[model samples]
Structures are given as C-alpha cells and as structure tokens.
Target: MIPEELLLKYTAETKRFQKDEIIFSEKQTAHYYYQIVSGVVKMNNFNDDGKEFIQGVFYKNQSFGEPPLFIDVKYPANAVAISDSTVLALSKSNLFKLLQDNPETHLKITQSLAKRLYYKAIIASEISSQEPAHRVLRFIDYLKDDVYKVEGKYSFKVAYTRQQMADILGLRVETVIRVIKSLEKKGDVKISKRKVYR
Candidate 1:
C-alpha cells in the first residue's frame, strides 16, 4: 500500500476524466507521473501510416509515466481514458522530493520497476512461440493469476477491451476475435456481451 501522505499529496493534484478523453499526447513533455485511482487508461502509439497500436492498459492503482520521469523526456505514447477515470498526478520535482524524504519509497519504486521488467520478459517469450489462440489463453491465465479471479466458469472485473488485449498480445484485431471465437467453440472460454468467461 502507498503511504497515506503520498496518497493525500496525490489526491490534491488529481483530476477526473471521462471515457475517450486524451490524458496526454505523444511527444508531449512528461511533467507529471500519474497513478490511477479508478477506471482504466490505455497507452498507444501511431505509426506513420496512422495505424494505432496500443502499448499497454493501466488499471486502477497502477503507476505510469516512469519512462519519461527516468529519462527526463517527453512521453513516447499517448494516454487516453477507457472509462471515467480519476488519476493522481505528481510533478517530477514533487516525486523526487518525496523520494528524497522517504528512502523506502524509492526502494518500493525500484521493486515495482523490477517486476515490470520481469513481466515484459515473460510477454516477449510468450509472444515469440505461442499461437494467437494460445497467446490469448496465456494472457487470460496471467490475468487470473496476477490481476483478478476466475470463479467456476466466470471471470470478473476484466479491465481490457478486445482491441487492447490484441495490442498487448501483439496480434491483429481480427486474429484476436477469431481466436476468441474458436476458444468459445472449443468450450475453453465464452464471450457474451463483451464479457469473457473461462
């Protein structure tokens, strides 16, 4: 859990955003590191052909903007809210101040960074050898083990859309849809009204 003082400081600078609202644009200077207090945010990049690719989805309690904070650079991707969201923003200077005042906080951030690196490695390994369907299955397993729960045949509180899932898995949207449908046919999973059950 984050420290209460840190939470208070963040709450003071936090703001609310509605669905589809652009939180920040690509190449924009990263002045603030944000922690999601509620809802979801998607980070994406667009190629020269204007084809958009999602980089990641950040859900509640997740922290982002670390790349910019560490490099003292602009954001490499744009961030947009996928639903009504409330995010706590801490300026670079303020964050540094907090870290300076609390060495433990800095260590905690380092641990978080290490965990992210480990997860990234796993994602790369899985995407390299798995078929699209298997990729989706592995992703679901990760979600179940790391993010949420699977009770009987139902999974609850999934925070990603099909497109976002495709982006994370490095698969095309149509491929994702087809793989999901195939899983449904196999009785491995089910999709109803955009909710997936396994």
Candidate 2:
C-alpha cells in the first residue's frame, strides 16, 4: 500500500461511502486507486439468478481494484462499502507518478497483489475438491495465520458472517451454518454466543 503522506502528495482525496453504496461498478473505467482508511469494503458480483458472489473483502489499510489501474482496463467487479467507510482515492495518472518516484513502495504494492493472487488460488482449490467442513476450516485457518497473524487454537475470532463465508466459498448459507456447528462438535472450533472462534 502507498503511504498516506505519499498518496496525499499525489493529490489523493478522502471520500466517504455509506453501507451498501457502490463505490465503483463492474465495467466502469478504472480512474482511481482506492485504499480503505476505515470500515469494510467488498468487491463482488451477482449472477444472473441473483446470487451474490464476493470476490474479496477488504479491511482498513488494504487496497482493492489495482490490476485494472495498472493494465488500463475496466473494473471486472463492483466495489461496495460493507459499512460506512472512509477511503482515499487517487487518480490513475497520479498513482503511476507516485510509483515511478518510489521504487520501494512499488515493490510493496507488487507483493500485496501477489498475496491476493495466492489467496485466490487457495480458494479455487478449496471450492473445487474439498468437503464443506474442510473448506470452511481451511479458509478460517488461513485468515488466522496469514491474514490476522493470531496464534493458538481457537484464539482468533472469526469476524465474517456465515452468509459472507458462503458467498466467498460458493456454498449455501445453510451449508456454512451446518459445517460450522459440525466443526464445533468435532472440537475444531469453539462457538460461544453465536460467534465462531478458531
């Protein structure tokens, strides 16, 4: 991610978006580089049958929709605020200028994008051949270890709702609920007060 000071130097503007608001839509021109300053955002798409498929959920300090900016292509998914959120938006031209002037920051951005690609690969494999319980467990484990960096079993609290998990994993909401409860019975996760911990 580009530092805020640098983004500001490149004329990045702070913008606020409300929950369920569409920040940018699929097929829209990639005009700005978006970085979340507060709250949650999701890049998602809807199927013809009205099923929602979440491409990814982004939290504070994370950047989304970068590939399109670098390649000069339209965004393939819509960016929406999951909660009332604050974001920094920089023009595509300004982002290129900032990167060109800052080699270290550019490298960091590349690494961030690489991690996203890696996560996508893992999800693809999990969705294809894994059983329901295994898929959910693996996804939660990845979030705990790599994304949240929390240690110890059942020490990390899962913040994503069951519906969100189902959307991302390509499972039905009922399946996600059942799998989580099954996981709890098996001692793979701990559920208390309806929140899952792992």
Candidate 3:
C-alpha cells in the first residue's frame, strides 16, 4: 500500500461513506485510486440471476479497485462500504505520477495485486470442488496465512459476518452457520463471545 502522506498529497481530501453505500458500480469508468482510512469495504458483483458474489473485503489502510485504474477500463465489480467508513480517493492521473516518482510504492502495488490474484486462484478451485465445511475452513486458513505474514501470529478475529462469508463462498447463510458450529465442535475454530478465532 502507498503511504498515507503520499495518498493525501494526491487526493487533497478524505470522504466519508455510510454502511451499505455504493462507492462505485460495475462498468463505471475507473477514475480514482482509493484507500480505506477507517472501516470496511467490499468489492462485489451480482450474477445474472441476482445472486451476490463478494470478490474481496478490505480493511483500514488497505487499497481496492486498482487494476481498473491502471488499465483504464471499466470497473468489473462494485465497491461498497461495509460500515461507516472514511476513504482517501486520489485522482487516477495524480496517482500515476506518484507511482512514477516512487518506484518502491509502485512495487508494493504490484505485489498487492499479485497476492489477490493468487487468492483468487485458490478460491476458484475451493468453491468448485470443496464442500461447504471445507470451503469455510479453507477461507479462514487463507486469512490466517495473511495474518501470519503481517504479525507472525496465528490467531486473529474474523472481520466478516456469517452472511458475508456465505456471500463470498457461494453458500447459504444457514450453511455458513452450520459449518461454523461444526468447526467449533471439531476444534478447528474457536468462537468466544461471538468473535471467531482460528
């Protein structure tokens, strides 16, 4: 991710968005490079039958929707705030110049996008071949791996709700609930005071 000082230098302002607010819609022209300053955001899309699919969730200090900005293409998915959120939005042109001036920051962006692509590849096979419980465990394990990279720790609270997990994994909310309880029973996951840890 780019540094906050550098992002603000390009945007000149921070904007607030409420929960469930659409930040951008699918097929819209990509115009801004966004970084979440506070709260959560989800990149998602709907299928032809109106089923919702979550591409990814981002937290504070995380950036989303970068590929379109770099390639000058329409957004393929919508971004929406999952909670009351503040975001810094940099103009695409300004962001490009910032990247040009800072090769290290550009490298960070490249690595970030590559990481997401790797996650997508794993998830594609998981969803296509795994059972609900298997898929759910794989998802949590994937997140655990990411946390391990950052903190060198194994346990972390899940940032998403059951419904959100269901949406992302192409399962029913009931299925997610059942799988979570099953995981708890199997000692694969721990749910303490309603917060999940793995």
Candidate 4:
C-alpha cells in the first residue's frame, strides 16, 4: 500500500461517503486512486435478475478500484460505502508518477493485485462447482484473516452481513442463513449477539 504521507501529498482532499452511497458506478471512467482512511467499501454489481454480486470488500487502510486505472478502462463494478467512510482520492496520473518514483511501493502494489487475481480465480471456481455449504465455508476461510485476528480459540467475527456473504459466495441469502444456522448447530461456528465466531 502507498504510505499515508505520500498519499496525502498527492491527494487534494479526503472524500466522505455515507453508508450505501455510490462512490463510482459500473462503466464509469477511472480517474482517481483511492485508499480507505476509515470504514469499509465494497465493489459490486447487479445481475440480470437484480441479484447482487460482490467483487471485493475493503476496510480501513486498504485500497480499492485500482486495476481499471492501470488499464485505462472503465470500472467493471460499482464502488460503494459499506459504512460511513473517508477515502483519500488522488489523481491517477499523480499516483502513477508516485509509483514510478518508488519502485518498492510499486512492487508491493503489483504483488497485492496479483494476490487478488488469484483469489478471484479460486472464488470463480468455487461459485461454479461448489455446494452452498462448501461455498460458504470457502468464502469464510478466505476472509478469515481479514475478519478476525485469531489468538487462542479460533474465535472471530464475520465482517459482513448474511446478504453480503450470499452475494460474495453466489448463494441466496436464505441459503446463507440456513447454512450458517446449520453450521452453528454442528459446532462449526458460534453465534453470540449476532456475531459469528469460528
């Protein structure tokens, strides 16, 4: 990730977005480099039947929607605030120049993007071939590190809602609810005050 100082130097201002607000829509021109300073963001799209598909979710200190900027392509999905959020928005050209000046940061960005590509490939296969339980488990496992910082007993909270989980895993929300309840009954996860722990 780009350092805060460097980002600040390039970012003219911090943009604030309310929960559920659209930062940018699908097919919009890619113009800025965005880094989350607080809260969460999700890049997603709707299908023909209006079903949502979540492409990615990012939290504080993370970045999103950079691939299109590099490729000079329109955004493939909409970026929305998952909560009240602040984002540092830099001109794409300035970001590119900054990366050019700092090869180390550029290399880190490359590695990060590559890791995301690999994750997408794995998720695509799971969505196409896995059962609901399998898909749910796989998706949770994928986000385990992000959602939880396990120290002793595998206890961790799920960062997303059931509907968000369904969108990410390509399952119906009802199916996600049933599978989670089943998981809880089977002792695969624990639900405490609506928070899930594994």
Runs in model 4 deviating more than 4 A are 145-152
Candidate 3 lDDT over 1-198, as tens digits, reads 688998877763698999999999999999899999999999999889998999999998899998999788999999999899999999889999999999999999998898899899988999999999999988988887753343333267787899889999999999999999999998888898877788
TM-score winner:
2
User: Which segments of model 2 are wrong by more than 4 Å?
Assistant: none
Q: Going through the candidates in order, what is the number of backbone clashes in each?
A: 0, 0, 0, 0
Misplaced by over 4 Å in model 1 are: 1-5, 10-12, 148-157
Per-residue CA lDDT of model 1 for 98-149, tens digit only, reads 8888889889888877766766787888899988988888888677765454
Q: Candidates sorted by TM-score, descending order?
A: 2, 3, 4, 1
Q: Give the Cα lDDT of each candidate.
A: 0.80, 0.94, 0.88, 0.87
What's the C-alpha lDDT at position 48 in model 2?
100
The global Cα lDDT (0 to 1) of model 1 is 0.80
Model 2 earns a TM-score of 0.96
Clashing residue pairs in candidate 2, if any?
none
TM-score of each: 0.83, 0.96, 0.94, 0.93
| Candidate 2 structure quality by residue, lDDT tens digits, 59-161 | 9999999999888889999999999999999998999999999999999999889888888999999999999998999999989988789999889999899
User: Whose lDDT is greatest here?
Assistant: 2
